[model samples]
Target: MQTEHDSTYISFSREEWASLHPSSQINLTQSEINHIQGLIGNLTNEEISKIYLPLIEYLSINMEAAKFSHHVKNQFLKKATKNPPFIIGIAGSVAVGKSTTSRILQSLLLDLPARPKVDLITTDGFLFSNNVLKAKGLSERKGFPESYNIRALIDFLSAVKSGEPCVQAPVYSHLYYDIVPGQYHQVCQPDIVIIEGINVLQTPKQVGSSIPSRVVSDFFDISIYVDADESHILKWYVERFKLLKKTAFTKPESYFKRFAELSDVEAEGVATDIWNRINKVNLEENILPTKYRADLIIEKSSNHQVDNIRVRKN
Candidate 1:
């Protein structure tokens, strides 16, 4: 019930957000939901029905409006303006469910009546390689703004926005914690492209040049910021770290293999250290500052449930 009239977005509690689309059907099965959710757990089919179904409906309406806008522009130009892909940027801190949200949205959008071609691209793939980072002495700041090849990421987005038939993006492997050599993700004529990352909503740093500045988010038709209290994010990061230690970190070739044998207490300490030293710093310096830039801000509870929704008034 609390809100600011001057704020760009009007806030709504989770219950109110769900009530906005009471007729939204849960087309996704439990198995499907399971596959879409990332490391953070505690998701149920009912939660998906209440939270994401309404979100999908809201996005569908927006997408249709975007198409109509393109149509009108093309009409005024007296020429066919090729329909470019509708790009949605999802940004948040580590373990904040950006991947899960992107994957679920991709699935739901594809099932729409038009059956739009939805492509999900994570900005992790755009990170500089470990070798490159090492060469630049930036290994410790891997997820920081300067650690990414922002130019290349912007170029890839520009290509997609230009309605290019096919574009390739570099691939980064979480297992090795580095970019895979000679590997690229091919995005071919997608009707919608979801760009998920910690820094997708970030603005370009001033380079003190006369060159026109362009941010990665300039291409987005809609942008979402997954938000949660810093305490919740820290807890989620620690929990996911423990889960990975039991799972992926145990693999011999995993970059984090050394932590695999850590005792629960030791693992928790490492997780906390990582959060305080790197993730939290990055969140405060780069990620959270961009929350207001999003068209939608989805606030999550400590249990990984959507607690509320805020939509930009304009």
Candidate 2:
């Protein structure tokens, strides 16, 4: 069967990818692994040692290469400041484990001998406020690229790339399903940063007419796409919805609190409809189209575990 791809990438089975530069040191503890695992995730330390640890080892090499290039540029320009932090971008479909993979990488990178400080930010915070979306009649398209304040997101990255001291990113709440009012994640200078979102790799032309001079991926030193069959993602999304219906949706303040009392079949049906209508459409037209743009792609199996990996040959 054909896999996700083009001639630009070389695919590797999970075993081959794990063996590329195997590391014996499992930097993350079991507790940390548990915390890194998302609602629908079953991440284990073995996977860390087998998959992510080696992945970061590859990243570290790239990071060093970037710094060397920066150093040479600085010398020619006669300046002394070190290069800006290495920025990594992660993208994938909803419920495809992008967030969990990002967190795990952040932990592993920090625990490296350099122990460089790392910050993670998600693009959810850049989403147009619920009020704004409703006003613009985009209430049904929350996760679509048009729903985001792409300029604001680009501005945040511009500041980071410029090595700004303290840049504040708007905070987003999943429970409330909106940007938090007057709240922000203050990002200080760090050795590395990871930006996570479903649409990070999307191009402006695909997004709409409001194209920035530079797209989000321009600032990324590395980009990753978490890949899985849409069928698997549909199952995962509905399962997560049902799980949340019993948990987060139960809270009175949850934006989806109305779903809290849904019966099993009712909850599944609602979630399925949402996927068919909104998320799947976004994934097809926007998210999946950008998959090949990633420097690395982690393909997952039906069980949501990494089954293969593809790295850009260039």
**TM of each candidate vs. truth:** 0.96, 0.95
Clashing pairs in 2: none
lDDT string for model 1 (190-209, tens) is 99999999998887686556
Off by over 4 Å in 2: 1-4, 25-30, 206-211
- Could you give the C-alpha RMSD of every candidate to the true structure, in order shown? 1.7, 1.9
Query: What lDDT does the true structure give each of the candidates?
Result: 0.89, 0.91
Which 10-residue span in candidate 2 carries the lowest summed lDDT?
204-213
Candidate 1 lDDT for residue 155: 94
Model 2 RMSD to the real structure?
1.9
lDDT of 2 at 263: 100
